[model samples]
Target: MRLLAVLDRVDTAPFTLEALAGLLNRLGPAQSRILHVAPSRDPDYLSPDEGMPDAAEHARFEHTVSAQTDTLRQIAQEWTQAVIPHRDTAWTERVGDTRTLVAREAAGADITVLSRPSPQDNAAVAEAFAGALYDAGAAVLIAPLEHYATLGLRPVVAWHPSHTLDLALQAARPILERASHVTFVIGENAPMEVPDPPLGAELARQGVAVHMDRFLLDTGDIGEQVRQHALSAGGDLLVMGAYTRPHFIEWLFGGPTQDILAHGTLPILTRHAPLVRL
Candidate 1:
């Protein structure tokens, strides 16, 4: 597997790097790359509405990047050495459009990993996420804010029937096949009458141990409910579809995917559905 870890901020990257290393261990020896894409130098691109960065803002941005450069390198070196004992790894930083750069890099990767977005750096994070999942059509692993040694040992799938879920399951098959145990949290949208859902049945055929439970939507916030159940069940990773609704709509009204990204603590394996054209 080729794993790409996209860093949004030097401070938050340790968790992402940890998750990347853990995923490398979980998925077996693989090539991994750590990438940081800075925003384009063009002032217009940086602030389209203003059409340029004010002198003070420009100075602050440059200072921030300069100050973080050494720290970024140190963290990258540490993680690179840490992973080198088990697999091949490298790190690089580039200045460009985040979305385009991330999409280009992720195109060659089996899975792209990223630090969960924070309020301070959400724009860049969102751009990178869009580039990887939406543009490159790649599966993304959003690392938890907290550190985790490893994941996929016991992954919980938030299950429902949809094209998005189908893609997510397919992308996560490697993890599922290797998991010690797999739990399916059946959403209210799923058919309850069936003793075995298609996904669970397929995993069972593959000799993977599987379990299931009901997740009624009306119970409360779906994201919170899923997170609690997974944690309570000892789940180390969360596997589910992302962004079922339009991105703008989700940003405005909120959706389960957004809710999970904002507050859930589990490392999430997710993929967006392909865009349809008339």
Candidate 2:
């Protein structure tokens, strides 16, 4: 498998890279590339009419790039040897727009791995996360800010019937196949529009142990409920679709994706923008 790990800023938690290495180990032998993109210019750093930064401004940008590059190299080197020995891993940094560069790199990778965005994340980290999932049309694994015990061992699904969910399942097939058991947190109040080939039966055919946890979704924050269920069920990872609603609508009235991103406790594997699949 090909894994792309995107780190957009120097101050990002070191545990994020360590989590990627740990995930690489879980996936077995795989080619992993760690990419860090230094912003060419910060927001409103200079106006377009300026035509380029003055000498001092250019020097500052260069300094920031150098620091970012050094940080990535050190983290990748130390963790590759300490955590994922014998794994094929490479690291590099470039100067460009974070979103565009991340999307370009993620398009060719089987799964893009990155730190989960917190409310405190700066513009770049959030943009990188958005790029990998929405712009690149790729599956993403979001690592927690702290260390995790396992990934893909026991996965909990936030079940729903939608094209985005279908794409998420397709992208997460590899991890699902490796899970010891899978749990589906289904909403009793929601429609059960099973596809032509039922997802549960298909997994059962593959010899996977499956269980369903049905709940009433009539009250409370659904996202919070999903997260609490996963934690109580001892789920190491949460599998689900992302951004089911339009961005503006989601922002206006927060949805599951926003809630999970803000308060989820476990690692997450998800995809976005259903119609566009890679």
Candidate 3:
């Protein structure tokens, strides 16, 4: 898969490089591009009635932004070689909104990889990048700061009888094919009509050691149970379909898939259902 990784000047963490390397290694010799996006420094005005900044302040902000961009280029150069070992990998720099830039660049690529933002920067560039790519119909991989390569190929698939689950499996087919073991976790009280047995068998046919387990949660904390199962199974990556309903729709009608997304801590590989069929 052709993958594009967006790096922002403000988000400089060592784990970002490690995550890129891991993703490239997992994807084999696919074409990968590292793009550095310069963060805008202009203070956004809340309304038209708000006064503009003085000329001196605006010039200072512009100068600061230029300096930051230069620093970003240097950082990108250092991080690119460290993260992407292959000589064929290409790097570029762009000046614009990171979210918009990534969405445009990821259009033709099969997948996009993004590092999770630091807790202090929860609503930071990473979230914007993820939302933009996902909204653009690209498969996204969100990597945590922890060293994930040491976790090995054993993975846990959080399964539900939904199209999103199928999409996640399809997007993670490469990993699943190479995984030593795959554990499917399902709700104990879920309806018997759930058709995951065939899916499990299919994975087994692809050389993955597959097993299914059911969990009963009295506290109704299914998210906690899923996380526990993955950890107990020694999973390196957690595969799940991302729930993509409108905020209002989900608020009134609860979604276990959304709950899992909110609580999952492992590197999550997700694809929207409609994209999966493609």
Query: Which model is ahead, 1 or 3, in terms of lDDT?
Result: 1
Candidate 1 per-residue lDDT over residues 1-278, each given as its tens digit: 78899877877888998888778777887788988887756333455666677798788877776667667778888877766455567877888788899999999998899888765554777788778888888888989989776689889998766787788888788889888889988757555743456778788888888999776566567777788888887888998887645452344236655667787889999888877988
Badly placed stretches (over 4 Å) of model 2 are 10-13, 46-57, 190-197, 244-254, 274-278
After superposition, the stretches of candidate 1 with alpha carbons farther than 4 Å from their true spots are: 42-51, 54-60, 189-191, 245-253
lDDT of each: 0.79, 0.74, 0.65
- Give the best candidate by lDDT: 1
Clashing pairs in 3: none
**Candidate number of the best TM-score:** 1
lDDT ranking, best first: 1, 2, 3
Those runs of model 3 whose alpha carbons end farther than 4 Å from true positions after fitting are 9-13, 39-43, 83-87, 118-127, 150-152, 190-193, 245-263, 273-278
Kindly provide the TM-score of model 2 when superposed on the true structure, using C-alpha atoms: 0.86
lDDT of 3 by residue, 58-88 (tens): 8887797678667766766776665545536
